[model samples]
Target chain A: MLLQQQLDGKITEQKDTGTPLLQVRNLKKYFPITSPFGRLKGHVKAVESVNFDLYEKGTLGLVGESGCGKSTTGRSILRLIEPTEGSVNYRGKDLLQLNQREFKGFRKEMQMVFQDPHSSLNPKKRIGELIEEPMEIHKIGTKADRMERAMDLLKRTGIREDQYFRFPHEFSGGQRQRIGIARALAVDPAIIVLDEPVSALDVSIQSQVLNLLEEIQDEFKLAYLFISHDLSVVRHIADEIGVMYLGHMVEKAPTDDLFANPLHPYTKALLSAIPIPDRKQRRERIIIKGDVPSPIDPPSGCVFHTRCPFAMEQCKSIKPEMLQQSDGHQVACHLYN
Target chain B: MEGYPLLEVKELRTRFSSEKGTITAVDGVTFKVDYGETLGVVGESGCGKSVTAESIMRLLNEKSTRYDGEINFKGVNLLSLPEKKMLDIRGNEISMIFQDAMTSLNPVFTIGDQIAESIIVHQNLGKKEAMEKAVEMLRLTGIPSPEKRVHEYPHEISGGMRQRVMIAMALSCQPSLLIADEPTTALDVTIQAQILEVINDLKEELNMGVIMITHDLGVVAEVCTRVAVMYLGQVIEESDVDALFASPRHPYTRGLLKSIPTITGDRSQKLHTIQGVVPALDNVPKGCRFAPRCPYATDKCMTEFPLLETLENGQKIRCWHHQEIMEREAASDVITAAT
Candidate 1:
């Protein structure tokens, strides 16, 4: 199917049912360099033509290595960073085209939980007051009303209400993360961009946060663009997974489908490298030859061609279009093309 | 086992005097590494894996640090050696590669000069001879155009190249033992594999004993000949690589093995994560340190910590209920695997 037809089909599908909470198309964010004279220099392609959709009650796992534009994509969608190009359609309204007043209204519905819990939360403020500040910014209710909601959110996120007056340093790593989650939930956002929310956590505590995320998703009917480098957590939480390389989405498929039959060579290499605990079932490790090339001057055609084990000459000259090989399985590889 | 072990650590305890109190970072840990063998140390953060490596090299701050145990490297008690004597043994007999390659490498010096320093220090080689040896070491580490790359600073090279340089400097003396503490944790997966392969090749070429410390079990499976599973600063389990993976004797080890997401199998199955977090140093459990979290903990397990007992095939286990737990787990595998 052509790209236009696939997009139209998705729109009709969403219209036939209910609208998707968030839809992103060709979103690009580039960091501009300034010359010594403070003139705008060439831009760095932090995120490039990324496309994905998060339904009303589903999680879309945006996964890649560090500097693969996962965080930039999240920040761009939330409009925390201005995109150099593309459309962000949230609830049928193009968020990219929204004015400041309109964008402020949309901000209440979209929130972000950052990677580092230790640095994300304010050290000076009490836990309750920190959570209440969001409500204060939005001017949602009276001071007493905001505190009551803050206490409810704190209790909901598995923190003691009595400890609400305590500082963030008083809590453990896991608890501090929970407080971060509570602060994000204070605004009652419909969509949450969880940026490496559990990467800072221990493996044992990671599961707890994951379980909590699942529970919150179920209860509030939340949509998440879960960005992370860890594939295991994405498999556990996301319904759909987008595998990014350099600054492009190389593959997007259901978690199970992507895991079972990864189409892209880069995806295959990544999967093969993950160490299975069981020693009996040894995998033929596909050792990719070289390191990831510089993103500023990414390879002309397929960004992954440099490290791709099965790269052809054509892969070096022409960019492969994102083509659907199966239902919900799209890959941008010359082999697939 | 087969040939003589190159390095052996017996009942090693590394303590530090913190502002809070005297804390034992590594408590009564013991393991051995045969020549040309990679013994992986697997544990969570603050589980004493790094401290064990630091203790072997005597790298901790001496004023606030206290060590109680024997680190017998090539028949010499590294603990009893004087500071001046240890300087000879450090890079010449036993070397270490730290986690962050960028921070570990001196920014002011070129890669060649850094590696050459070790050669000059350990061997009586002149600067020119040391430079040639440095290029040889860099080339051995699989770096392309080692001679050209040697003159570049640490910042000039990629993370992978910097790590290779670190490996080159560490093995410049051809140390019988190499201690790597999360060497590839900062690099991407592809680079991580390369670093692991580099370490493996060097271990084989130099006939060196390698102690690899990492939290990722997958890396351990790929490289380690034997594994010592540490928890709360103690070696909870120690066995051959295959045996440890096949039948983990300790609950912590079992949980760690299960917790790692296997790329080979079905993705639908829920990962068996260990329930609770690692207890803080001051809040050490009165009984088994893992008793608060272990699913198989009983009244006996809650009252006293189990001694490290030698099981069949010389596998060491620090759990009182290992026999019973193994039996129950075997029976439940049918149900667990189906799910």
Candidate 2:
């Protein structure tokens, strides 16, 4: 369906083809390190020149280690943390240029679900009121309408109505996470940035939450930027996967292609590092030596050259640009060149 | 005594009296660990995996915690040992490495000093000789430049390095038995792989009987010789790592295995789930603890508890309908293979 908009007092019909729900380009977030006296020492480049396009009703998974800046990329897109440099284009609009009052309108279109559900949900408020509070903040509906919507959302997310009046402390970890999902859906967001949504849950509960997320994605046609450190969980839910290392997007590809033929050496090592549960299928693992380097002073060219198995002389002096290998496969490595 | 296992825990029942009431955290847990063998105790949260490890060490508060079981180390009953003698056996003979390496290590002391202190206390070594042994242990764990790294404090090193240091300290005195409780849980995937490799190499070198307590089945499959699956406060199934993965008898074990999203698993298929949450300790069910979540639970399962029975294959299963479940599963496997 073409959306008709009144732009400059004239009606214009815009086609939805080739328009991504969200586009992040050259995203860079650098936290300045300072001494106790407030003198700027240096900058810890958390995220550098990361780019991706998230289409509507699609899930893009971002996988990385602890300091690889996957969570920073997700938060920067939602403006939860201001980017040092980059543009977040939401449906052809630059969300970064918008002021607080103007950005409030787009906030309703995008919501975030934090990693720890225990700290994310308020302990004092009843579960029902917590879900309705988001709608109340956005001024979307009346008190009774919000209550009705909240109750409906709770039931849809597999929570019983009898527990609506209970506090967050009374619920289990899985149930609290379900309540978090219910609250995120309260604002009717089109794109939800889920940062390690099920990482804290047990295996059985993690699967239940994953199934619930898939069902809601189909029913509401929502897009997700699923950020997690678990590759298996990401492979099951995400359509496309992006691997990041030391604040750079080393590779991005369709889930099937990435798993079948990973291009980057880091990606290969990460895939092999996962301990397969089956005893008969122990693949030869490429164990990367040494820990990740400090982001404050990342390697001169490629941040991964410090521990990369196939690092060349050129890899130490010149950074490899992300090159498209196939239709939807991209890799940043000198081997491809 | 010469032919006895390195460590054997018999009917290990651990209870704690809290403000609410008394709760049996680890009930009737029995297992044996032999030299050069790693026994993995896998379970979900609140399943008494950690408590079992702590009870073996007698680390819990003696005032509130009560124990009624035989924890035999080298054919000696540890439960009857006095606190003074238990202190001598705590780290010298049986050492433990906790999940969080940061809190387990002393922050104020250098890693070398901490390692040396253990050696001096246990092996009757001088300060300089103990320091040399500490650096040697760090080098054995594959830490680069151990001479320099030994001077660094716990906070100065990275998480993976800290974990390696913890391993170095735990293995410094050449303990016969090692109890690692989720040692790599706080680490990243690649780092976890490295740590597991280090542990594997050290276990072979020392010929130590290792008890690995974790919730990750993948870790168990990688490093464990035998696996024991725990539910609530009991071991639901115990078998060799290969056998447990190939054909898990208990319904809870099957459900847990199916729930894990493996990289090689078909993405289109929905994951299998256990129906409900684990019952609280105070509100535990009267019969089988897993009956509420088990799909094959019958009326008999709700009122009667099943004993842990050993099969012909030497695998232990605690389920009344394991034979029926195995037969049905075999039939389904045949049908699927035919298709």
Best by lDDT: 2
lDDT of 1 by residue, B259-335 (tens): 65555544444567787678887678888989999998899888987888988698999999999888988889878
Candidate 2 local lDDT, residue A92:
94
Q: After superposition, how far is residue A78 of candidate 1 from its true place, in Å?
A: 0.8
Clashing pairs in 1: none
lDDT of 1 at B201: 82
- What digit string (tens of lDDT, one per residue) describes model 2 on residues B130-221? 99999999999999999999899999999999999989989998999999999998999999999999999999999999999998999999
Q: List, for all models, the DockQ compared with the true complex.
A: 0.43, 0.51
The positional error of residue A211 in candidate 1, measured at the CA in angstroms, is 1.5
> lDDT tens string, model 1, A1-337?
5545533432333233356678899999889888999998777788889998888667789988878999999999888988999999988899999988879988989989988999998899999999999899899999999999999999998899999899999988888899988988989999999999988887777767876876687677688899988787787777789999888999998777899899999898887776666778787878888677777778898898887778899999999999999988999999976
Q: What is the TM-score of chain B alone in each candidate?
A: 0.96, 0.98
Q: Compose the digit string of candidate 2's lDDT tens values, residues A1-337.
A: 1112212111111123368889899999999999999999999999999999887767899999999999999999999999999999999999999999999999989999988989999999999999999899899889999989999999999999888899999999999999999999999999999999999988878989998997788678788999999999999988889999999999998888899999999999999999889998988989999999999999988889999999999999999999999977999999999
